[model samples]
Target: MDRPHSTSAPRVRRSRAEQKRETRDALTVAALVAFTRDGYHGASLEGIANEAGFSKGAVYSNFGGKAELFLAVMDYNLGALRGADWDPLAMPEASGSGAPEPSAGHDEDPARMVRGFGLAMLEFIATAARDDTLIHSLRARVQVLIDAYGRVAAAGRPDDEELPVDEVAQLMAALEQGATMLALSGAASIDSALLRTGLRRLVTPAAAANEPSPVRDAHASPLPDVERVRRLIRDTIDS
Candidate 1:
């Protein structure tokens, strides 16, 4: 019993760099929430710092200013989406591989989070359009996504196929941005499943796209039965 002595673990300390990184991350999360609530024009560094449980100086020290902070938030959110854990971009695993199966949201009400961030992002993009420097930064960040998409497109196509990466990326980006905005704006008909199908078809090889879809359902068709309509028209004409 005399040999039994309780010892406490030594206190571990974070280096200045580690502490700084932690502060930046906390600030980013708080800024994400604040930006979503107030947007880029309405939000303030002071409010974000307070939300993050830090002084306004922390935001200034970690980020140049609001523009920088917003970019950081964009990177964090968009990067997470691009990661292997999620496929928000509707990127196919292979060129013609079947559409990725839909999965449940990772968190409670994930759609809310998506809409919130999407709103803030679109607002900032609109605002940035008027600012050259800010737009440049935004373009650079967006280019990263486009580049990744180009790589994927190139991968899916045969080496002989003339897949203009830039063109392909531009089309995919346009579709993705437009589709996301529609979905976030409460388009009941626009969901991930449809988005996946649209994106999958967009990059599918010309030869494969002409072939009847291997999977068919109510969602697959976007219009009335044209063949049936044509047959009825012919019958009516004959009659």
Candidate 2:
């Protein structure tokens, strides 16, 4: 007996919105890789689109242009940085959740992640220095992050901890940026112990709550030990 042949309809295509979201995600990923490798001025949208297997038209349709795309990539990297648990060694016991995972690559390393963020921040600073439009955009984004942090802090705080959430957020952001820049410059180095001590002072609630700070008193001490620590870091870097 001959079996009758039958055909089912082909699988349904993805919804237009799903397809668009996929495209945007792919472009974002490609842009991050490209920008990290080539830097802000060097990575082109056309190249990013090509790498993502999308057309340049697709990029234009999804984003306003290169600057907007660059900012989106910055946002993506920053989001990853925020998602990762920061190094427990850098904070007091109460402040630290856990040590951040070992980095699989430059994009994954916390220091390098902070460095990448610093570079993007530099771009924003440079643009804001000269352009009104970018200044406005930067201010709006800053406020949004601050407000978002305020909400998270409010939700997470215990009833008794009167945390100055916004100030804490600002200090953390500033230190990460400054530390990355300093590390990259190679002009000076901080020993791990000294680094941890320094960070703990700024990061823990005692200082973060806007109280009379130990950091203000600790600076009065001599730094012969700190200098030795700096030499060790330089030697490690040179090696």
Maximum-lDDT candidate? 1
Score candidate 2 by TM-score against the native: 0.61
Q: What digit string (tens of lDDT, one per residue) describes model 2 on residues 1-239?
A: 99977788788999999999999989998987777667677778899999999899999999998777866775764454333343423322221357353234521343343345456566656866687777776666666555544544444445565548777556544554455456556665443444445545544545445534334323211211222223333446559
lDDT of 2 at 189: 47
lDDT for each of the candidates?
Answer: 0.67, 0.57
lDDT (Cα, tens digit) per residue for candidate 1, span 62-97: 999998999999898656555544333342233235
User: What would the TM-score be for candidate 1 when compared with the true structure?
Assistant: 0.73
Q: Each model's TM-score?
A: 0.73, 0.61
Q: Candidate 1: list runs displaced more than 4 Å.
A: 1-6, 84-108, 185-189, 207-239
Candidate 2, which segments miss by more than 4 Å at Cα? 1-10, 84-121, 140-163, 190-196, 203-239
lDDT (C-alpha) at residue 147 in model 2: 50
Best by TM-score: 1
Q: Global lDDT for candidate 2?
A: 0.57
